[model samples]
Target: MLKKSGLSFLWLSAVAFVIDLASKYLVVKNFQLYESINLLPVFNLTYVRNYGAAFSFLAEHSGWQKFFFIGLALVISGVLIFWLAKNPINKKLQNTAYALVIGGALGNMVDRSYHGFVVDFLDFYWDIYHYPVFNFADVFICIGAGLLIWDSFKNKETSE
Candidate 1:
């Protein structure tokens, strides 16, 4: 069943997850909290921990957000696995997207569960204003989301 399904793409998840964890490990080992290393005028490797969701949403809460996010990630991972198992292997784009999401979701979930926060390092900024600090998991998730949108449009085009 799953052996012949999009579950075949699960390796992509492992890759994303491992890269994310490894990057975080390096950051945690070499830098203190709030440490920043300028890599370019617009980019840096900064260390920060998020106890909330994207853009530090609900970051000011009284610790409940950590459990909530961890639970949410778990649910998302389970649903993605079910979807991959149900989808055929021919759904390459969709499967790839799902696998990436699973990896990103689980990567963050592991951090949230173990450290009570997600370690973010990569920082991209213009001159003054800076985007939210993020990690490889966020990159993978954003890429996966973009691919999902692209896949939807591709499917719509084929159906017409």
Candidate 2:
């Protein structure tokens, strides 16, 4: 059995998964394909299924790319979980970031494995400039990566 803190990490992962899945489900059910519902001056909700990597990279591939990416996500998520286990529990922010990344990766990986793609519904744009359509899982992964980068910079500054 794991300790309380370890259990907490697991719980966080579960929460992330639930939230990611729920949001994606809502988007898939409520939005139409290629339809944009503007929420803010610079944001819109548009349903899109990506069969490739971040920003739909390699999306044009025949089909094998889906499984390739799914396998990659699984491997990456596994590594992140292992690292989370070894990390100190007192580092709440770091652990949370890891949990987010792991959950997000798994979320998209599920879609890619089962549906051959990920359902992205959130779109940001300003006139001609448009950001990639993304989902909750992407948000978590991006935020986690940002946090990790910030932490790395902080540590470097402290050590120097």
Which structure among the candidates has the greatest lDDT? 1
Clash-forming residue pairs, model 2: none
All candidates: TM-score: 0.95, 0.89
Q: What overall lDDT goes with each candidate model? A: 0.94, 0.83
> Among all windows of ten consecutive residues in candidate 1, which has the lowest summed lDDT?
151-160
Which residue pairs clash within candidate 1? Answer: none
What C-alpha lDDT, on a 0 to 100 scale, does residue 5 get in candidate 2?
A: 46
Backbone clashes counted, model 2: 0
Q: Write the per-residue lDDT of candidate 2 for residues 76-137, one digit (tens) a residue.
A: 88888778777778767778888888888898888777777899998999898999989888
lDDT, residue 120, candidate 1:
99
TM-score of 2: 0.89
